[model samples]
Target chain A: MLTNEILQQRLTEKFGELVYNFEQPYGMLTFVTDRDNNLKVMNFLKESEDLGFTFLNDLTAVHYPDQLGKELAVVYMLQNIQAGLRIRFKVFTDITHPDVFTATGIFETANWLEREAYDFFGVNFVGHPNLIRIMNVEEMDYHPLRKEYPLEDQTRIDKDDDMFGR
Target chain B: MSQKQNIQLPEGSLGKQTTTLNLGPTHPATHGVFQNILEMDGERIIDAVPTIGFIHRAFEKIAEHRPYYQITPLTDRLNYCSSPINNMGWHMTVEKLIHAELPKRVEYLRVIIMELSRIADHLVCNSVIGVDTGAFTGFIYVFELRELIYEIFEEVCGSRLTTNIGRIGGFERNFSELAFQKINHFLSVFPKAMKEFETLFNRNRIFMERTMGVGGIAAERALNYGFTGPNLRATGIDYDIRTAHPYSGYQDFDFSVPVGTTGDVYDRYLVRNAEIWESISIITQAVKKIKELDPSVFHADIPDFYLPEKADVYTKMEALIYHFKIVMGETAIPAGEVYHSVEGGNGELGFYLISDGGRSPYRLHFRRPCFIYYQAYPEIIKGSMLSDAVVTMSSLNLIAGEIDA
Candidate 1:
C-alpha cells in the first residue's frame, strides 16, 4: 500500500523534471516522462530495492491524431510483486519517428509486448533485436490500430452504411 | 554422432546444424492456433520460436467504434471457454468508470456466475492436459460437466457460447427460478465428476512422469514474465486478482489461493485442480448469500442505461425514449480512464479503458495473459524433447482466441 504522495515525492527526489505530468485518475498513480529517458527510468525502477518495480505488467501504445509532435503515447504498466503497488508509466513519441528505448533489456517479457506495440501502433523500440510485426501479417504494410484507419472492416458486404443505420 | 559427417556442411557454421520442423499453425499438439518453428538435433529441440497472430480479430480496434454496451460481445470472443467472466470484467470496468454502486445481490450473483465459469475453464484446461499426457478418459468425463455449466449459462443468458449476459450496472434481467435450480444442480453434480477426474490422473505413474519435470520454469523467471492466475500460482506466487483487487465481491468469499513449488507441468496441473475446488466452494458460498437477498434485485437501479420491457416501451413515454436511446447506443458516457482486472480462467484478465466522453472508447487494451506467458514458451522448451515441447504448451493452457486477441 504505497500512497500516491510518497510515490510522487520518491519519483521527484530521484529524477526531477523528467518525471512530470502527475495525475492519479481513479486513484492509480499515472505519470509522464521524456521518451528519450524511457530505459533510464525503467532501470531506476527495477534496480532500486526500495522501489523494486521489477514486474513489467504491460507495455502498449495509443495513437493520438490531434496531438502535435508527440502523437503516440507508449504506456508501460509496472508493478511491485512484494508490495502489490502498480503504476502506469507513459512516454510520448513522434508519429513520424517513434523511437523509445526497449524494455526487453530490463524485463524478458517485454520482448513480445514491445513487438505487439510495434505491430499495432508503430512504436519503434530502438534497441529491440527483432522489431517486426507480431500480431499482424508480415506482408501487411501499415499498423491497423492507429486512429487514422477506420474501425470497420474493408471487406464488409454492406457498402453504403451511411445511407441507413450507423 | 557420425550422422553429422554424412550431412553437407554450411559455409561458416561450426557445430552440427539441426533439422527444422514446423509444429503448426494447425498441429493438434499446439492446443490452439499457434506456429512454433523448432530446430531439432534428432529428438532434442535446440530452440523454438512461437509465431502467433493466426486469429487476430483486432478486438481493441473494433472496441473503438462500438458503444459502451455493444462492447460486451467483443469481450465474449476473447476467452470463449469462460465468456461470463470476461463479460462481468468488462461490466465491472464500466461500472468502476461511472462510479455505479451495485447491490449485494448483484455482487453475489456475479461471483456465482464467474466462479462457475472458472470451474468450466479449469476443467477444459486440466482435462486437456490429461489428454496430452495420454489420459483421454478424464477429458471426456469432464466435458459432460462443462456442458452442464453451459446449460446453466443458457438458462441465465439467452445464448450458450458468446453470451453477452450482463448489463453495465448488473444483469439484463433477474435470474429465473430455473437458473437457480440449474446452479444448485450443477453445484451438487460437478464435485463428484471433479473427484473422478482427479482420481484418474492425479497419481497415475504415466501422467506424473509425463508432466513432473517437463517444461519446468523457476518461480523467479515466471514472475519476470508477468505470469498470473494458475500458471503463476504453479510457480509458487500467491498473487490472485480476486484477493488483490477484490472486485465483484470476491473479498467477501473464503477460498484459498493454491500455489505450487516446482513450476512444472505437474505443478500447473495440480494448481488448476486445487483452484477448481476453491471455485466450487466460492460458488456454494455465493449461492447461500444470494438466497438471502430479494430475487428482484438482480439488476441495480439504473433505468436510463438498462433496457425496458417490450410491453412497457409500447405503453410508457419514458420507457419508449429510453428504449430508443439504448438501441441507438446514444447513452452519453463520462470521459475518464480506468483499468479494471478480474481473475479470469486463464489468468488475470485486465481491461484498460480510456473514454473521451464519446460513445466509443478512445483506446481499449486487454491484458491478455496468454499473450504475455506465450512469450516465455521459447525459453521453457529450449533443449527439451519435441514431445515434451507439446506437453509443455498444452499444460500452459493457452486459448488461441485470447492469445491472438
Candidate 2:
C-alpha cells in the first residue's frame, strides 16, 4: 500500500537522524532535512525501486524571515505513480548563504523548478547550470518573494490613504 | 566574379546562412503570448529556445497578501481556458488545511462544473491543433460548442472568461433551473456537432501526415519531465488525477481514462478528443447523481466561511453578523500547509498553500503544469521542421496565463 508509516520508516532507517521533523497534516507525509543532504535524499528516494517516487509533482520554497539561521526552506513534492502516493520533503538553509545542491540531475523537471525557487526566494541551487532571472526582468535586482519584501507594489507611492477614502 | 567573392568572403559571412527566426513573443501561431527563438537551416529547426514570463504578474507574490477568498479571482487567471478547476483546486487546498467537511451534493455539483470546463478547454486545444495544420473548418465548427459551455458558465457564475465560480464550501448559490436546462440542452446538441467536427479531421490524410510522427516523446521521458493530464496520458500512462486521487467524490461516478501509445502530436490530439467524450459522460453521470440528491443542497455547512443568504442577512442579526465577518475576511483559519491537484484543461494544476492563522496566506505556490511541462518544448521540437513546431506547440496546449503565473 506504500502507506506513510512505510515511507517514513524507510526514510528514517536510511538517513538516521539526518531526516527529522516528520508530520502528516492532511494524510500526506511531510518531513525535513538539512540543505546539504537534500539532493542525496531525493536521489535515493527516486532511484530506490521500493520507494520509486519518480514523479516530481511540485518544487518550491517558503521564506521565513522570523526563523533565525534557517530562514529559507525548499519544499519538494514527489508522487508514486502506481500507488498514487505523495510525500513532501523540505530542506532548510541559512538565508544569507542559501546554497542547496540542485536536484536537476535526479529529476529533469527540477531544472526550471529550481530556477524558479532561486528566482523568487534567492535559494541558490549550487550546481544549477543556467540560473538567471526567469519570471522577473533582468534589471530588477531583488528576490521579490522573500518575506522581507512587501507584497504590494512599492513604486506606486501616489495612492495615499485619503486618495481612496480609506 | 561571384565564385571568387564567395571563396574569399569575410569570416562572419563564410558560414552556412542559418536564419534566426523569432516565432513569436507576438506571432499569431503561438496562440498566446510566448516567444520561441528558432534557429533554422532552411525549413528544419536546428535549435529552439522558448522565452516565457512576458505576462508575468507575480501571482505568488501577489497571493501572499490577499485573504483566502479574495484569491479565487487570482486563480481564475491561472488557466483561463478552465478557470473553475483552478478556483476549485485553490478552494480544496484551503479546505484541506482547515478541514472543511463538504456535502455529497456539493461534490457532484463540482464534478459537473469541472467536467464542463474540461470540455471547453479541450475544445480550444484540439480544434486549434487542426487550425495550425491548415484545417480551420474544425476549429470554427467546434468553437460554437465552446459558446454553449460558456453559456452554462454565464448562467452559473455571471462571468465567462474568468469565472470565479466555486466557493470554499461550495457554490455561492444553488443552480438555477435555467442553468440545468442549458446544460441539458448542451449535452444533447454538443455530441452531434462534436461528431461532425471529428469526422472532418479524425481520418483526414493531411492532418495525419502533419501530426503522425512529429514531436514524439517517450513515456519514461515524459514522466521525468513531470508531464501530467492529457500530455502524460498521451504517453499511455493512465495516471489521471481524478482516477488516481479521486478528489471531489470522483469515486462515486464511473469514467475511463483515455490513453495513447505513440506520444506524438496525432496521439495527443486523439487522447484529447477521446477525453472530451469521457468528460461528457462524466458530466451526464454527475447530473444524474445531483438529481437523485435533494435539490436544496448546494454548498457545505461551513457557517463561518460560507456566506449567509441575502434575505437572511437582511432579516436576521446572527446571519448579518456572519455575513459581515465572512465578507470582511475575519474568519479564523488554521496554521498549516496543504497541496491540492485538479485535472485542469492542460494537465495537473496544483495549489500549494501555507497559512499562519491569519486572514491571508503566508505562502502560495501554484504548480502550473504548463510551466513545468513547457520546459521540454525546446527538446521536443529540436531538429523538427518549422511547420511541425507550430503544430507541436498547438498540440501541447500551452496557456500563457498558467505558464507565466
Candidate 3:
C-alpha cells in the first residue's frame, strides 16, 4: 500500500519544497534537505499516522571536501517495519560549523550513533547529551574520518611506496 | 596487625553502599573483550556501563583506501562466527552498484554457504549461553557440528575462521563434488545433533529458571534500539531482511521466520534453535535447486571484476590482461551510492558505499548491527543479578570485532 509515489507525495505535501532531490537509487527513496529541517522532517515522518517510519536503521556521515559550504553530509536510514518501507535522507552542513539537531529524542539508538559521527567526522549534534568519542580514545584531537585527514601518516617515510613496495 | 595505622577506609567503604565492579575487557565469562562497569548492591546490579572499542580497527577508513575486492577480507573480520554472510553481503553491495545479474546456480550456491555459516554462528552463540549458565556439556557437544560446517568452508575457499569465500560477482570457482558431499554430510548429521542440543536445554528446569524473566525487554523498546536478526525476532517482531527485502535469490527459498515472546534470554535461545531448523530446511532446498541449473555457471560474466581462470590467464593474452587488472585493483567503478544489507549472524549487516568513479570507494560505512544493539546492553542488564548480566550478554551475541569495527 505504501508505494514510493505515495510516500514522496505525502512528504512533498507536508514539507512542500523544503525536501528536494527525490531519487530512487537502487530502488531506495533518498532525498536531501538542509541541516536546519532534519529534525522537523524526521519528526513528521515518525509522528504522522500514515508515514510510520519508526525504526532508525542506520545513521552515518559522509565527508566531501570538494563540496564548498556543504562539506559534511549526515545520512539517516529510517524504516517503517510494519509497512516494510525504508527512506533515506541527508542533511548537509558546512565543515567549519557542522552542527545538526540531535535525533536521540526521536530514536534512542541515535545516542551512540551520534557520538560515533562526532568522533569521526566531527558533526556536532546540537543538544546531544554526553557527545564524546565512542570508538577512538578521548585524547584524539582531530576527527580522523574527515576528508582533510589522510589514512596514513605522512611523516612515516620508511613505508613510502617509492622506497618500499607497500 | 589487626588495623594498620596507614590503612584508610575509603569514603563510601565505612558505610554500607553499592560496590563498583568492572566485569571484563578480557573476562572469560564475557566470551569477548567487553568491559562493563557494574554498580552492585550485593549480588544485584543497580546500574551498568558498557565500554566497547577495545578491538576497533577503523575498517571504514581502511576501506576508503583499499579497492573493492580488497574489502572482502575486512568484512570477514566483522563477525568471524559467520564471515561468509558478511563477505557475500559486501559482494552483493558492489553487485548492486554495478548491476550485475547473477545466475540461479550461483545464487543457490551462495544461499547454501550463507545458511551453513548461519548455523555455525548460532551454534556458538547458543552453546555459549549454555556454558554461561552452568551447563558445559552442550558447549562441547555442538562445537563438532560447527567444525563440520567450517570444514565445508575450508573445502570451498581454503580458509577457516575468516573465510573470504566469494568474489564481487560470484565465487572464485564452482562448487566441487567434494564440497557437495560435505554439504550433504552436514545436512544429514546436523539435524540429530541440533535435536540433542535442544533436548539438553529447551525445558531443563535449571536453564529455564536462570534465563526466563532474566533480562527481558518489551518488543517496542527492542525496536527503538534498532534490534534485528534473531534478537529482534526473539522480541516477537517478524521483520527479517531476507523476507522483508530479499536479495541473492532468498525469495526462491521457502522458510518460516521464527519468533519468540517475552524476549528473554531463554526466548533468544529458543528462537536461535528454531532458526537452525529453518536454515536446515533452506539449505536442503537450495541443494536440490542447484542440481537443476547448469553446473558451469559459477561466477558471473563480469570480467572487469571477476578474475579469469588461472589456466586461461597463463595461456590467453586477453585473460592475462583481465587478471592483471583485477589483481592490481585498477577496476574503475561508477560513481554511485548504494546501501545493501543481508541478514547476518547477529542482525542486519549492511554496507553503505559511495563511489566517486575511482578504483576505491569514496567512503564506506558498515552498518554493524552489534554496534547498534549493544548500546541497549546497560539497560537490558540493569537491576538484574551479576550472573544474569553474563547470560544476557551471551544471548545478545555481541561480537567484539563487529562492535568495534
What TM-score results for chain B in every one of the models?
0.96, 0.97, 0.96
Residue B180 error for model 1, in Å? 1.3
Compared with the true structure, the alpha-carbon lDDT of candidate 1 equals 0.89
Interface RMSD after interface superposition, each candidate: 1.0, 0.8, 0.7
Error of 3 at B93 (Å): 0.4
Question: Which DockQ-derived CAPRI band holds candidate 2?
Answer: high
Select the stronger candidate by TM-score from 2 and 3.
Answer: 2
Question: Alpha carbon lDDT of residue B64, candidate 3?
Answer: 91
For model 3, how does the per-residue alpha-carbon lDDT over B220-313 read when each residue is reduced to its tens digit?
Answer: 9999999998999998999999999999999998999999999999999999999999999999999999888898999999999999989999
How many angstroms is residue B63 displaced in model 3 relative to the true structure, after the best TM-score fit?
Answer: 0.2
Task: For each candidate in the order shown, give its overall lDDT on alpha carbons.
Answer: 0.89, 0.91, 0.92
Sorted on DockQ, best first, the list reads 2, 3, 1
Listed in order, the DockQ scores are 0.82, 0.87, 0.85
Output DockQ, candidate 2: 0.87
Summarize candidate 1's per-residue lDDT along B26-108 as a digit string, tens digits: 98877778899989989999988889999999999999988889999999999998999999999999988878889999999
Clashing pairs in 3: none
Q: Which clashing pairs does model 2 show?
A: B24-B35
Model 1 residue runs over 4 Å out of place are A153-166, B2-16
Give RMSD (Å) of candidate 2 vs. truth.
Answer: 2.0
- Candidate 2 has an lDDT of 0.91
| TM-score, cand. 2 vs. native | 0.97
